[model samples]
Target chain A: MEVNEYNACVREWADALFRFACKCTGQASDAHDVVQNSFEVLWQKRKEVETGKAKAYLFQVAYRKSIDHYRKKVKITFAAPPEETYTPANPDLKKILDRALAQLDDQARALVLLKDYEGYRYEEIAQITDLTETQVKVYLHRARKILKEYLVSVENII
Target chain B: MISWENYEEYMMMHADGELKPAEAQELMAFLDANPTLKSEMALYDLTRLTPDESLTYHDKNSLLKPEPVKRVISFPKWRKYAIAAGIALLVFVSLFKYIDTNKNNARIAKTDTTKPIIPEPANNTSNKNEPQPQQEPKSIAATTVQPAKVTHATHHDIHPQITHNKQLANTKQNDNALVNNITPAAKATTEISSLPITTTKPLPSEIAMASPPMATIPAYEITPPAKPTKRSLIDRLPIDEANKRQLKTIAHITSGASRSVSKVKEEIDGNAITFNIKNNNIHISF
Candidate 1:
């Protein structure tokens, strides 16, 4: 891609890449680092990437960097009380969804973010996440099922 | 086509927005037929996450690149030619100056080598009463012959001779005034006849008889200065007039002789003299 086209990619997709990275890494600072690194990699490989494919290339690099970041961090125990014991007092849908998203693993969360937030097709998501189309579909489905189960819980719905 | 066994797959595809419109309609129809399963579709729909439009990479300006700069310099045709001509002129002048200097140095060396050595005249204070040899007259006659040894005397040799003649003239006037009162003409004639004629040229008898001699007539007044000493055509000129003639002679040997003389004169004058020889103009200032 030309320098102007790469800059256009920065203007157009930086936020979406950041959002995806934020959802994957669960930390705003790590997500910002991932976004910065992704764009840096895109600029380095601009000669090889087409202008149209810059967004996908950015997401791919962001996905790998986010995965690396996820691997390096000490695993946090996301232990929740039993579904019956939880209170359903929180009505903020965005907060509830964020809590629900935090329940999923890094790869599955990135798949969900790439699908729902960016609205990439299964094939495109597979290209970004480096998975087969069938695997992307299966993972996304499983992630969606988890989110549905969380939302459907009586404590979460109220 | 949408049965209970395959209903979940259609619902998942519907939530992911990957299902065809006809398949989605069929799944909705199957969901409506089973109201309990319609609640499951609501939960699937809720799984979709709306992006937070506010979240953005704030420092995106850092990623942008600027256009590369190009610099070029060009000169006009006339300016190029003018520069070339200036360089050519400077080189020509420098070469001419160098050749002129070398020629002047060589000419100065030649002139130095050929310079005549002026010998001191013989001692004048010998006994006058004692009979001297007939071949040699006294002091003045001996001094006259010394000029013959310097065959190539230049015009510079004349200054000392002129000064010597003036001194001799003064001495002769003083001696003649004193002696003319006391000595008679017949006594002076006897003394003149007694003096030896050393010169190769015979004295004219009529002139000797016609002349009224004093007790001491300077020998130069008697002999006519040894026929003025034979000299080269260049050396015959007076010193002031010979500069141009000498320059011309050196010019025949080296082309830049006149210019070299001018340069030498300028150095001697310490730039106090300005002599310019230009086309159709000669400028001189002091």
Candidate 2:
């Protein structure tokens, strides 16, 4: 894609990338860093990227950066507050839901985001997650089942 | 009325949104009969639709922002090495020249005289001359009448006074022969002896007298002074009276040798006036 076109796409897609990074790290600052780093990588290798495939390329970089951020977090053993902590809770449902989401493994959570939040097809999720399509379907199914069970438990407790 | 085999296909198709209206109707018919499975499907749909509070997603467009990369520049290996080597070579050459020039100058300044400039008067003129037949009359006239004038400057390794006495004899000889005859021996003695014993300054005539003394001293000292015609010859002379004895002795022996060789069959000629005379030794030329 032309640089201007690529830039427009980045502007359009930055929120979504931030959201994904926010999901992965559960911290806005870490999400911002991951998204920023991914874009930098994309800009560096933009010439090699196909115009139609730039979106996929960008997601791939962001996903990698997000994973790296978590890995580093784990290595350093830093404890970050859940994303919903910033929301002043009228009912505290958001905080409860966020705590439940954070409890999921990194891969399972990424699969859930790719499937439900981004509306990626099973095949595209598999490509992004480097899993088989069947695996992607199975994982998404399981992730949803787990979320349903956890949310029900949380609601009952509330 | 829905069999378990049909139930799996029904739920799978519903989840995928791929059910035909009739197939969906059949699934609903099955679900309405099996209420437990219906609740499960409803629950799954709700779970899928509900927003994840903790999660935020970024699309590719959002993730790609431009940043600048800095490049590192470096100098080439061979060029740097060549420059270093050139500087080292220049320093080495300059230092070598400095040491060699200083050593050479010092060696030249302290040099002693071993080389000789042999007086080759025979080379200048080829002639046979005899001594005057009235040798006694000449001696009586030269030595007795001018005892203070005829001086023979003879220097021995032991004493300088001997050379001074010989110089007195040369003055006496010249006193009888010609009042104006400037005998080098008498001139040097008279000029040197006239100066205060401790004074270092030499009269102009003494300087002239000292020139011949340098010739007798040695050949090595002659090379440096050879370039400056006036100062070189005189400069080679001993600066101190103490060293003059050695110089005069060397001169006396050299002049004596020349006189003996040239004295055979000498007759009185205007140009043949003898400058060298020792006991029973005379040189004559025409």
Candidate 3:
């Protein structure tokens, strides 16, 4: 793909990618960086990539970048992971949800996001997360069960 | 009939729309029968909506913020290509130089093993039966080739006439003339005359078979009368020039050899030269 065509696609997907990255990372600044860098990385490998799959490619790059950020942050601090984000504006519910989500592991949290928020099918989630289709289904089922259990307990606590 | 124990899977899959048509119908029937289960499913569905709203808020805020200054993704293509080419050229030139030097060394070694052949002058006699001079041409050539010997001959105390005459006679006279004139009777007479005197250095025994027969004329004698030798102005200039040229050639050879060795050593340290003893071949490259 040409640079202009790539830039056009970047322009097209930038907001959606930012939204997905924001959902994944929960930090506006980090989400913007993730979106920009994903597009930039896509542009670098633009010759080998197809224009039709560019959006999906951008999301994949953003996903990996967000995960890398989480891993790096985890190493430096033992605080709550970024994905289980709670904001001050909706402190009560946000705290409950954050507590619930944090109870699940990294892959479980990612699986929940990819499946529930992104509406990805087990097969698509498998492809995106580099898991087998069976593993995706199993992981998503287990993650949902864990979230459901946490949410029930959180409702009781709140 | 889905059990209550797996009821959450039914609710989640129903929410996800992953349940097959028949399975969805069964799940729907089950939820219709259980109002509490339907309410629980609704609450889980509510929790799912919150993340999306947060995501939209964050996304809008990010989009509202001014886009980042586009970072110039510098490729450095030219510098990369130039560096690659330079390394390739260095490796190529070093390898060629090494091979050429090795070939030259091999040739020199081969030449060193073979003895050099030197041609001796044959006797040209005016008499019917004249004896031949037996001189080893190889030794004569080796000794004659030494410039130091020529300088010594000119330096030592001796008859200047005799030495001058001797050098000339050696050049112009054949072996037969040298053999005849160097005999004691002929030499004494020749010395008395203003005529040039020639001397014959005795041949080594190995060369005696080829030497002229001992004439009753006393085979060899012509000692130059001792006198303080005058250093001639004529010989010095030519000898100095010859010495200078020899030194320059030696210096050139040494410098060339040293440069070649240094280039080879550089290639070795750089790991550019690979010798494959199994294949009996060498490959030098980047």
Best by TM-score: 1
Task: Give the top-scoring candidate (DockQ).
Answer: 1
Candidate lDDT (C-alpha), each: 0.70, 0.58, 0.60
Candidate 1 lDDT by residue in tens digits, A1-158: 77778878888988888888877887788888998899889889999998988888888999999889988878944333234333436445666677788899989888888888988999999888779999999998999889888877845545
Alpha carbon deviation, residue B178, candidate 1 (Å): 99
Off by over 4 Å in 3: A75-99, B50-286
Over A1-158, each residue of candidate 2 has an lDDT whose tens digit, in order, gives 56776787686667677777777777778887887787787777878887777777767777878777777664422234444322225545545545656667777778777665677777887788778998876776666667667766654555
Candidate 1 DockQ score?
A: 0.52
lDDT of 2 at B208: 36
Assess each model's interface with DockQ, reporting 2 decimals per model.
0.52, 0.22, 0.12
Could you give the candidate ranking by TM-score, starting with the highest? 1, 3, 2
lDDT tens readout by residue for model 2, B63-145: 44454456887779998899899999999999999999999987876552332222222111211131212122221122222
Prediction 2 TM-score vs. true: 0.41
Q: lDDT at A77 for candidate 2?
A: 28
Show model 1 residue runs off by greater than 4 Å: A77-91, A154-157, B69-286
Q: Is candidate 1 or candidate 2 better by DockQ?
A: 1
- Poorest lDDT segment (10 consecutive residues) of candidate 2 chain B: B152-161
